[model samples]
Target chain A: METDLGLWAVPIAMLGGAIRVSTPILFVSLGETLTERSGRINLGLEGTLVFGAMSGYALAVMTGSPWLGVIAAAITGALFGLVHGLICSLPKVNDIAIGIAMMLLGMGLAFYFGKPFIQPVAPDLPAIPLGWWSDLPQVRAALQVNVLFLIGLVAAGVLWWMLKATKIGLTLRVVGDSTDAARALGLTPSLVRTLATAAGGAFAGIGGAYLSLYYPGSWNEGISSGQGLMAVALVIFARWNPIACVGAAMLFGAAGALGPALQTIGVSSGYYLFYAAPYVLTLGVLIATSSPTQALSGAPGELSINK
Target chain B: MTLPKFSRRTFLSTSAALAAGAAFGPLPARAAGGMTVGFIYVGPKDDFGYNQAHAEGAAAVAAMDGVTIVEEENVAETTDVQKSMESMINFDGASLIFPTSFGYFDPHVLEVAPKYPDVRFEHAAGLWTEGMPSNIGSYFGYIGMGQYLNGITAGHMTASKKIGFVAAKPIPQVLLNINSFLLGARAVDPSITCQVIFTGEWSLAVKEAEATNALADAGCDVITCHVDGPKVVMETAAGRGCYICGYHADQSPLAPEKYLTGAEWNWAGVYPKMVQTMLDGGTIPNFLRGGLADGFVKMSPLGPAVTDAARTQFEATKAEIMKGGFQVIKGPLKDNKGNEIAGAGEGFAEDDIRLESMDYLVEGVIGATS
Candidate 1:
């Protein structure tokens, strides 16, 4: 589909692709928000994303209900994170390597479960046609959004408030900023962080399920185009703020949509190079904003990745 | 429309129950416990390629007597394949299981088969996976026949003398296809070159598109893909104003302009026959490689762009194969190195091609394996 960028359609396509792109990131970054605030990092969300896509798509096809498939996916993802949490709960297993192993295991599982779902039309997700609000033809095209996209927006706001205002959030942050501080205050660092990781894992699973159950329903080995890992990268760019994560996720979305947008507008040259927009934008953003001292900048203390 | 969020998409319920030829077949369940069949696919059924074909086959079975099928797409790796298998057997109560990927043969199907001796497993692509639960069988189409015929078209149509072939992985089955396609392409134009690109993974649209564009830039006018998804070779070809033959399905929509033609596996026609065979109290033969004659495989509709000469030639080649008169790797075949393949009318045995764990490339195809 050659998106005509000059006809005011390019922006519409970008707006549409932006939401499509942001959904996966919203889920992953939200999960990361929970993780980073709780003093841990599950760098294995990429694997979780793949596995969730596979499992969710497969299960949805099997049961004939995409929602059940989603639930099944969430459960699988939580279990995956639980394993990560349990592994990290013990001493000496680097959460990074364990995350890596979990990633492999998650991807492995997704591939296996996804076998039969390779066929059949997945039940399509319902979209809210907010385009009706605008009589402009372009607005209609631009505003054809999924309910989950809106839910993601709300989720970002609620999560942001939770981190800033809730006691659990404060405690988790305490444990994250300084396990010693939490311990001095009689708080359990291990418990708070473990729960956060599990929550993050669940969100990652939902991110995965979103890919299969919504934008492109049904299972396939190639269903996920690295949305999970990109979400993780997006979290770093979001500076651990769930609200900002949405904007960052959408920027990445716009970048990804640029290639198709350019091709859509009758300028098809260098089309292959357009696929690199997200990575290029991502690199540009990180270089522009990242503080030289990881700790001196937006990074939370006690996160294993910074160290 | 507050599109009430429902979780899954259900194809028509499969009311399928068939008699079991083998002793370990499904015991006739009560009116409620009819036949339950399970399927494992390599990609989402909606992928419109490999898994979708098999799912349609399974759905066809569901359309028949007393069968209830539960299909799972996007099964992760072998371990999870085994998990999905086990769950189908123990939990979903599937009497028959089809793991539609060749990769799932050993680690997944074989590992789970012995545990459920009462259940039968029909696996795709496991020439070796034929043994299991005394009831397991393997099925494959002679797709090499279609690939060879498509080659006749490729050879006849290409003016640039260059053909591009994109593939997913270098497994033996895929390797055989590349060999057959090249062999056919060379049959018509001996000077024709087939440049191959490996996407490393299956059905990845972006990578497929990128690699395809690079090939097109190098002046390859004719293209083909063993990979899944319309987002790749088909779309890229249409956008770049090139021609391509599709695999697995009639992907003409993606490249209506450049659609050259493709080979499609008629699992719908082939699968019901297998179910009937099981019901008729007959055991499936080992190493069953079904083809056009057997109705497991068929050629897709030629696209508008495929010339009459090309179609006519391909049709003739296809007819010969259906008659069991054509052999791809038969003697007078020379290696790309100009060495005699078997020397003076010697042919590659079914073991060499059928058990075909081939690594060598035929003449006219160029690429390297890292």
Candidate 2:
């Protein structure tokens, strides 16, 4: 039985678990990366994540197409972002607090709208495995990842290139780095932030769709633990880079799956301790990478928290 | 039945505060000129658990008669419930309102029920009646019956005589299930010991999976849940090979290898009767408790894999229970401690105690407070 849980099992299970669990985190972090790229932070992304899960699941069941659930979730997420943008854009409203309120509202809306889709059957996302080259069953199983994992990776690489080389990416980075600089250059910071936030919202929505349609395609109020909120911490860990976001999210996924994997080996003591793995890792990495005075590597200069 | 001329935009607007039209089942429409009733929910109507059952029941009522039910889903706390109640009364003309939440008891409903004497109200899962108006009454289910059956299956499945239960709050409704599940499992194995973990939220699939995983680690082969969703439980056990029983619905399809069997409440058996009674010019009977006799509660489809030994014993036990010849909470009881709960030969009487306030985990349960 001990052989059943060797170092190979842990890493192999983690590879599969990371992809399964990291899909949502990748979407939300990528979304946050876009919003921050445009000189704004959407703390309300957490609410958007859950609400999207609820809305996406409900719509998929009602519409009879899971892909439509993804589309519906994206629309709802964008709308939520639009509302947040509108609220923050208003004269004196604080974006942070409005984000908190939007979080509450988004959750409330999800719980309300998502009520019916809880038990209904919806389409499940198809997983694409590239591990066929591996002769080992465990390695082959680990390679049985979802199409979204590959998409998330591609999105990260594409987003990284876009931010580094594209005109739109340069303008967004400039807006985030300095609102005054953006204004001096004849670009509206608010406009850039708003559009960026919309993109972020779309990502958050897709992230929620991952929870309902792919990781486990079905609806329930309990479907989301705190993947949305945790994505915020993940974004900080990623330093607003989509590439880093994938790595950090997979790490968190591995941490999240630790307890389950441990059970297979018959280690049950201190089970509650395992529940703290992700949060602990997140905090540890944040503390390790954080500098009290120096600007974080790759962090946007104009960002308030980063500075 | 008051249908204030249906303008297209205000099709659901009856005068209730935010008492918007809601869907029950496959169909959703505003009751144009139908006697509009209002239903207020503490959570979403599609929770696939308790809330879903109530919503389905309300929807069944809407299909028949001078009745149109509008639900305000995801209404906030008691304050919001009260505000929604007012909206149902003063804003929308809800002659009958169902406050389908456990917390909306004395403070929310009792305070408001008397003022709105014209509106008939039904408080789900409430017992207080001191300040309640004549128009209001409370009702609930003997969900313990289903829990008991589930425990019997757990007893059958546990090779080690060890099982786990993941619950929401330690409130009476949940405690009742824990206690009854123990009784049922014990009735079969007599040696089965159940350990329970609380997640504090009916929903929270992640925490639930974590908790269940912890239970699986703790050596529980048979797991049962009193949560809002079954997906997490199903998926977590799918790979680990733990046996699972679900609440609210049969999720055997979600994880066939792991899903042992589940117990569910059938609103189909109860809603039509209540609606028919109301249509026949009678008020919904106050505090009506329904059981297997009335079909208000039902066991979900037993998985094809349930053993003949398990099935035979379950059917016999169910028949006795249905005939009222057996009560899971009946005599020869003892608390978790070795102390005798009842007199040596005595049985606990129903009239002497309230099942909702039970906090102790009888014998054979390894559970904790809060």
Candidate 3:
């Protein structure tokens, strides 16, 4: 097969790669956004993401349904979050340290349990061929979007709305703003943060499910590649806003797609440099957004690390 | 702020002294009174590719007499690997250790080998030098021959004369496989051109899939790869309806419909032999190299997608390779940049060190190593 699509194919392929790669990041960052908004940071979401991937893949392989695998992943992720939440809720327990410990636990458990699920091919999540209207093969292949990506977009919108328009959102916000204020308002800060962390973990887990059951569609140790950690940075970049997380994830995805996209255009020189695009973009984002004198204006007042 | 800081030279000397002391440490007594061999893998045991190939070999040796196998999976090629080796030595009392990843050769294996001179160390796909410790050995198979055979199948299967190669890195071992595959394909169809994409990392599943899709979108009817795991590449190519030739292990099960064949490591054939030779009081060669005749590497069974003619050709090539006269990286070769690698009348021997350090792609290969 000799494709003569030429220069036009680069952006099209990149667009496709961006959608495929960003789905996980979108889910994870959205999850991180919720956690950070509730005055907790779960750095162990990387472990959650990996465990989710392993659980999702194993369940999908066992059940022959990718959706069930996804649900399993979400549940597993939520459980990890719950553990992190409970452990950190104890007096004098640092959330950051607990998060790091949980992350290791999640990864260890996943690696230990994911041993048998490595080779088996699980049912893959389906993709919608939005590119059917295109005459060009490159365009058509590039436009084949997975269903999870749409769900992620909807999740972003719903999360954004929930954060602004609901009583639960107000209570969570009050809990995040000040524990004293929450106590005065007769709210349990620990319970609220724990639920938020669990919710965040569930979102990260769905991202993991997307990795194992959708795009790359396989279970392995290297599947996450620090995307879970990157989502933490992404949350900061998004100012802990769920809607902005979608945009940030897509941007990261586009950066990641840059190398392969250039290769299609016959740009092979210095190819390894292009693989650093995402990391470079992340550094650039941090440099642009961070102010040394003060925390980013949108950071919750009760967020201990910011102090 | 009040802490004392050591000078760079002082720090270096102290660390060097510590390493040397650790290296020349007194030998610990064996507890089990039997041969215990340890195998460390950089990936999962069932990655269906690179690590799995080694694990299979480990399993082969595990069944041997008086041998206790202590296996550690997901061991990275960093200082962390040194800890795993130490644990295997100090805890499991392993007399032999196989740190199988390519990157484990330098600091990790070198650092650990001297510490336990009594223990034999065999690293896979390593470049061992004269200056390295005597107890350390390197073993690798000529899997490029299998790649060449797989290329022949791809050449016959592809109607469009365009093939895709998804590679982990542009290192010599990977480049050799890519070039050999292209050479074999060109032997069948002179006009066949292979577009190669390097994913930079050994196990970036997402990049592997994207590269496969990009290749398919570019009209590459046939695809192959040299990544740590071929699962992503194989599945993506099959998903994109492209014929695939896998690497490291047989991935036909992943994409049976679109699978053409694969170049696989036959570590099972050599691991037992190596261990048995050592058990029988024979020295394991410092640099062990084997070819198809020795059963170090073998081609996967041809898939339904492969034509009968391609199979016949593959069999003939296999027979020739087994007869000990086949050399894939022969002379009369020119790199893709049109530089003469070998003159028309000259070629390197099968075990040529030049092949080990191969830096350029052969003619008909489309990609830059840089």
Candidate 4:
């Protein structure tokens, strides 16, 4: 069972595992950051993620093109988000409640439709080998980054730039900051928020695609494992910043990779505890950063969550 | 049926009669006019994993003469499952109920069984004690036997002499399968080793995939898993160009060229017999266990990737296990931690509670229990 490699392998494996594991979280949290920035919370992205996973995998299997599957997943996610946005726009409708209901609906639909795709294998997304210089097989394998991870990194930068510099970004910020201000400015807050939510859903759909069409690369009911929901907490931890979402996601992925990394180095005691490292770290971050008496810094003023 | 207004003495007499009936009278049958069986699954009916395995079993029983089967899918192991069972008994008039999830046994089954004494409850993958209720019985397949067979194949095919296992938890059943797989591998090549990773979830696809990749990166040439569903593991490993073995169901179709063999549940072989035994008014044993010999477990057909030598060795090992007196958890066994689990010539019988409660990995298993 012993590998001849020295002690340096653990950190190297974790770095690679972090990149692989964090890709989904990065995409999902970035999506949530957009939605929350526009003063809405889509708790139902969990469902969207699963639905996207199913739709993405099923389409890849049917179409034999992984990119097409990703597009389909994004479209499906956008549709789910559009539904949530339209429903929540009704007078006196609670977005949080609707988000929960939509989550169940999305998951139910995915499971119902995903049954046939469970046993079939879908085509995998291609990966870029980045470790050609390394002589060690472990290093070479670890550095084989998936294409989606690179896309997610680019998406993070683009989202940050768009949210900060674009006119659409100003409109979303104004609407999220104060609905009354937006109405006075002749802009419909609901419409802006709805579009933002849809875009968010689209991003989450890609995250789901990453889960089913790349890393795990299979369609099943248990594909997402609450990563969609975890992105909500991750967004909060990132102070609703898209760039910070990437870092936060990498932190989570690194924590998740800790157990396997340690095992590769033959440090296997309390393995289950290591599995819980991500959650524990998330909890610790939340407790340390949260203020009891004041709204969180950088929180969108019109956002309904936790207020 | 209106109740008659009764005087105090009449009420007392009626209460006494009811108490006497409850204490000494034969329990009424739960089913009213037909044999109705109910199954509750923790996942969708077609998950191609543990739940699907049970669903297939329920379908088999449904095919039996004069038997009707009703199922509630995606039921969690909570009070919600208890409610589903009650409704099946009350509305569907199901006499026999199978709550197939592992977590359903402790509080849910134990709490519900006493409320409906006439209804027989069969739980899968449970540890039943002597003091447990008589109406509730537990059964599980010896999947380790099939896993061992797969291990022999893995042992022979692996050029690296390192195999990877993606396991769900550190529970005894899972540990037993892991150890047996390693033992079977080492039986062929004494130097073979298995590197295991527990994903901490029964059906988390992403984690299972990551673990599979991690193992492959660590130089394991062959990979198998004890996850609730083997879809992601098989797919990930195969996509990574690694040879794969599966669990819970046959997954060769997922990756034909990379597929080896899988440890599959043969619940269809046992469910009909169980239903028949119940229909014939026979008591099901409190602790029912069976293996490949009795058809409760099976091996998926070997794929083209499997060599003829591995196939021969696997078949011979399987036959030896089927002939009885072949114990996988035998003497001179030391845990991965170097502690002697069983000294030379000292071993627990197959199906022994000690074996059932296995807590350590055998030697050459590169994994931890905690």
Provide the TM-score for each candidate, comma-separated: 0.60, 0.74, 0.93, 0.91
Task: List runs of model 4 lying over 4 Å from the truth.
Answer: A1-4, A285-295, A305-307, B1-33
Off-target runs (Cα >4 Å) in candidate 3 are A289-294, B1-33
- The lDDT of each candidate is 0.72, 0.74, 0.87, 0.85
lDDT of 3 by residue, B1-370 (tens): 5657755544554466466557865323243355888999988878889999999999999898888889998888887798788777765678889999999888889887886799899999858988899999998988888889989999999988999999888999999989999989987998999999999988888888888888887788899999888888888888888899988888889978888888888989999999998889899999999988888998888888788899999999989888885778777889989999988778765677788999999998988898
Error of 2 at B99 (Å): 1.1
Candidate 2 residues lying further than 4 Å off, grouped into runs, are A1-22, A47-119, A126-172, A179-199, A220-226, A237-299, A304-307, B1-37, B129-136, B157-162, B212-221, B231-244, B249-261, B266-290, B330-346, B349-354
**DockQ for candidate 4:** 0.46
Query: Deviation in angstroms for A270 in model 3?
Result: 1.8
Write one digit per residue (lDDT tens) for candidate 1, span A48-153.
Answer: 8888777777777778887787777778778888888888989877888888788878877776766556555466456777879766544554565877788889
Instruction: Report how far off residue B253 is in candidate 2 (Å).
Output: 6.6
lDDT of 4 at B120: 97
Q: Tens digit of lDDT per residue, candidate 2, span B1-370?
A: 7766664323343422244323332122223544557888766676556677778788887787767777887676557787788766655567778887777776778777877787778777647554447788777767788888888877887786888888777787788788878788898889888878776666766666656654654567788888766567666655446788877766677777667677777765776676566656798867677666568688876776678888888888788778863567765778876666665566542222367677777887776543
- What's the C-alpha lDDT at position A161 in model 3? 91
**Would candidate 3 be rated incorrect, acceptable, medium or high by CAPRI criteria?**
medium
Quality class of the docking in candidate 1, CAPRI style: incorrect
User: Across residues A1-307, which tens digit of lDDT does each residue of candidate 2 receive?
Assistant: 0122354555666666676688889889999888877767788988899888877788777787777888888998998888887777677667778888988888878867675566666776667768788665545545657777788889999999999999999999999998789899999887788888888898899889888876655566556767888897688799888899999999988787775555444443455576578898888888987889876777777665654
Tell me which of candidates 1 and 2 scores higher on DockQ. Answer: 2
DockQ of each: 0.10, 0.21, 0.63, 0.46
